[model samples]
Target: MSEFLTWLFATLFVLVVIAWYLTYTAARLDRLHVRLSGTLAALDARLVRRAEAALELANSGLLDGATALILAGAASESLESPAEHGEARETAETELSEALELALTEPVVTHVRDSGPLGQEQLAKLASACTRVQLARRFHNDAVTDVRRVRRKWTIRVFRLAGHTPMPHTIEFDDQMPATLGV
Candidate 1:
């Protein structure tokens, strides 16, 4: 009888430990999902801010006609891209980055710097927004990677700890900023 009791107690302890582990993992996965959502939201905001800054710079009459047109078109495309069209949005953002790089050439930077306080301020704002976008993208991708790693664990799969949550995807785009901007 004592032997049976010992065996039963041991089984109960093992089950309790497994339950605790599963609960902890599920809670961690939930937190990671929350973090991923927040990071993605921040990334979206930064992208919008970048497009808005580019548009402002384009319309400020600070740049020449041709460059201004290119910048405006790219910025408008990026801003107008629908959330459902993920690939289109990525492509538009990449095009905008390229356009910004080409438009903010040496001569344009020199002119902006020489234009005094307001030009310098606008330039600074645009540069800051671009930098923020890059940082946010990196953070978002990192979070996606972390969540993917956790979700791929055998324990998570066996216990269905992640539930019905859709897998997270990394954001990929050419967010390279112009070196001339000093970002």
Candidate 2:
């Protein structure tokens, strides 16, 4: 009888340990999920702002073909019904393509008219901004991957048993940024 009791106690202790590990994992996963969501949201807002800036540059007669493409992509995604606006969107895309072709074939002027800094300095700042944005996006994706991996573990099936549903990939926007910032 003592032998049986000892074995039973050992088994119970092992089960408890497993349960604790799973709970810890779930908690960690939840934290990562929240962070990933927030980071993605911020990134999306920044992307929209950049796209708007590109559009503004184009409208200012800057002859920035890249900006035209950015504006077109932003417009395409922002539209609720692509089919309804297909013709107009297509025309815009064609124009943008021509602009890009022209820009690529011609020599690019490295001049910066924003008198605050030299053109090279301004270009460096833009490059740094682009790098930071890409890094943020990568970090967000990494967090998302970790969270999803934890949630998919067989030991974490208890979450499903408790009616916890898996989260879907979501892109959130910052409300503080202008609508142009979230295009």
Colliding residue pairs in candidate 2 = none
| Model 1, runs deviating above 4 Å | none
- Consecutive 10-residue window with the lowest summed lDDT within model 2: 174-183
| Clash totals for all candidate models | 0, 0
Error at 22, model 1, angstroms:
0.4
Candidate 1 on 1-183: residue-level lDDT in tens?
A: 999999999999999999999999999999999999999999999999999999998998888899999999999999999864278889999999999999999889889878888788889989999999999999999999999999999999998899899899988889988888993
Report the CA-based lDDT of candidate 1 relative to the real structure.
Answer: 0.92
| True-vs-predicted CA distance for residue 101, candidate 1, Å | 0.9
TM-score, cand. 1: 0.96
**Best-matching candidate per TM-score:** 1
